[model samples]
Target: MKRFFPIVFTLLYMLAMLKPVLPVFDYVINQDYIAEYLCINKDKPEMHCDGKCYLMQMLEEQNNEKKQNLPAIDLKEYPIGFVTLINLPSETTTTTPQKNHNNYHNQYRFLTSEQHFHPPIFS
Candidate 1:
């Protein structure tokens, strides 16, 4: 009984950590936190990229596209018209500029009094 305490506690701690209620079977069993998402061929025994693996081929295609690329895009080709701005709910009724309130500074303002400072600004 005396020697069994350490072993029992260790087992209980491990069991509590596993948290089988949540989906962590992949991390617990397979030791992988995230499941692989890369496309894998079912028929092939080894990784055999039909063409994609070559870096040079991809770069060449990109360069060729850049050479034939148009100077500017035509908005007519797109189904939706170009939108510059979006209107949302606003609170203010008047277009007039708001006056400065000195409530926080005890009614003393540097800019309003036409005062300027050099470097080491805080001092």
Candidate 2:
């Protein structure tokens, strides 16, 4: 009976270790957390890849559907035309501020939480 117990225990241990080695166990388990929620609402939805919102796949499909047969011309093979290059002025020009002076400090204040006073101040 002692030999039987040890055999049974060893068999159970072996069974425990016989699980499949899953590299992509994370993606299979956490599908909801990795969904492209933005793309879900898109007019023409696209495939979700690594939880990123991409328009590349949709654009490629649309391009393929609208593709027309045209001769592939190489621009480099054509003779070079007269090239006119205009050099930009080296000096920097300052322009009037688009916004008022008060709006300048508002950028930083928007990012940070507003500071509040606990009690009314006495003059």
Please report the candidate that would top lDDT against the real structure.
2
Candidate 1 C-alpha lDDT tens digits along 1-123: 987999999999998776432333433343321223322332453665322223334456656766788477776787565666788888787778879885675765555655666678575
TM-score of 1: 0.19
**TM-score for all models, in order of appearance:** 0.19, 0.18
Encode model 2's per-residue lDDT on 18-117: one tens digit a residue.
4232213433455456453533434444432543333344445545654654567799888567676889989988997686556345544445658865
Model 1 residue 42 distance off true place after TM-score fit, in angstroms = 17
- Backbone clash numbers for all candidates listed: 0, 0
